[model samples]
Target: MNETKAATASTPGTHAHTGMTTRHDTWWLAPLLVATGFTLFIVYATFRAFENNYYEIGSIISPFYSPKIDLPGWPFSPAILILWMPAGFRATCYYYRKAYYRAYFLTPPACGVSVWGSKSYTGERAFPFVLQNLHRYFFYLAVLVLTILWYDVFKSMLEPSFHFDLVTLIMTVNCVLLSGYTFGCHAYRHLAGGGLNCFSTNESTKQRFKVWEFVTKLNEHHMAWAWFSLFSVGFTDFYIRQVCAGVFPNPVFF
Candidate 1:
């Protein structure tokens, strides 16, 4: 009877005024900015992804529409063939999940801030969120796509014959930033050596520990990498698309 009564009793939340936090400053700024930036990118990327034109120029192809797959009867954009890999990888990214969760969902937008109508949480064991476990598999696919991106960049050399252009530099920088963000992932860090309690086990373990150390350094700035790469990739596609659209010529130099 006591247990039932206790369970049925309603209790108020933490003490303090101003909605679970006494903070009077502009605490909502970060999430608001994040939401705005991500929303803009979503709109831009969606338009670019679906429009299916100007995504390629000479040897440069937008990251969104890579590999250039063509099926005999498929009547949709070729991006649907490969874009899902990178999309899935980013969607399941640990840093991105936290980012969108706070910015978009506003499930307690910030530390000590509370959202109305929220219930007790049992972690990501719930539906939809549990799908995040696929991050590791997506990490493997990300690596594969990264390799292909490198191949595309190399093609820039052969097509234009050992010359460099603004697009090449942009593509290279974007690839580097994407690589940093990807290698810094928590899932990738775990693969470097998560379960191992001891790094002194043997030479192999020592090697993995070194890799883990590198990934840890990258993970420390994972958020920064995420943002930079996001901008870089988006700009890369935009610049290439503009060049393809005859808005401007891609300045080339040998």
Candidate 2:
């Protein structure tokens, strides 16, 4: 053990004995921005979930409140009943795990940086971290929620007579962006056909291969989809709140 320590200590590219890279570039900037953006989103989402009142305006219910459910005798926000599905899905997302692990936990911080636990480190094999495996289950739940959200968006355009408005456009874009993100999930890509050993096993397998290919295309841009969808959903909620508060004008073109 002493000899191994001596060798590690002798390594010159990283700081002595600490294993951290001695990069002179702005490597810290990425983590700083990621942490800041995540913090802002969390704070905004929490406030909106608890506030709950301005989430519904006519057929244009905010993404935060679609398929609205409030338990009997429940005193808190209805969003409590709805937010968990998407929130859990995002929290356990494969890409997001990398983001938070680096930014929040400083576990490597960036691609080449050495983490505090680089030695004897086990990735997601421990207690709390093991819960990340539930990402697949969360994907299932999020799909159900996304279905409801799509319905809500169409309802907004059709209900109380057909009309197109700024709110409708915003909600539509939010749902589309979210669909791209959710369908591009690593769990979803695997579910699409990752288990199959051959794509030409039969007619059914051939069709499944097509789905897998489509999902693969989306997965190529999963990171972009993830960020865009997040912004869209948050903006949808904010715009709805503004309309509810009479602070923003939502013009309709019928």
Return the lDDT, model 2, position 14: 40
lDDT of 2 by residue, 59-104 (tens): 7898888788868999999898889889999999999998888789
Give the Cα lDDT of each candidate: 0.82, 0.85
Candidate 1 backbone clash number: 0
Q: Model 1, which residues run further than 4 Å from truth? A: 1-20
Report the number of clashing residue pairs per model.
Answer: 0, 0
Worst 10 residues of 2 by lDDT: 10-19
Residue-by-residue lDDT tens digits, candidate 1, 1-254: 24332222211232222234445677689888889988998899888878989988778898888888888998888877887898899889998888787788665566656543345544589888898999999999999988888888889867868878888888899999999999999999999988998999999999999999999999999999999998998998898899999996788877
Best by TM-score: 2
Deviation of model 2 at 66, angstroms:
1.5
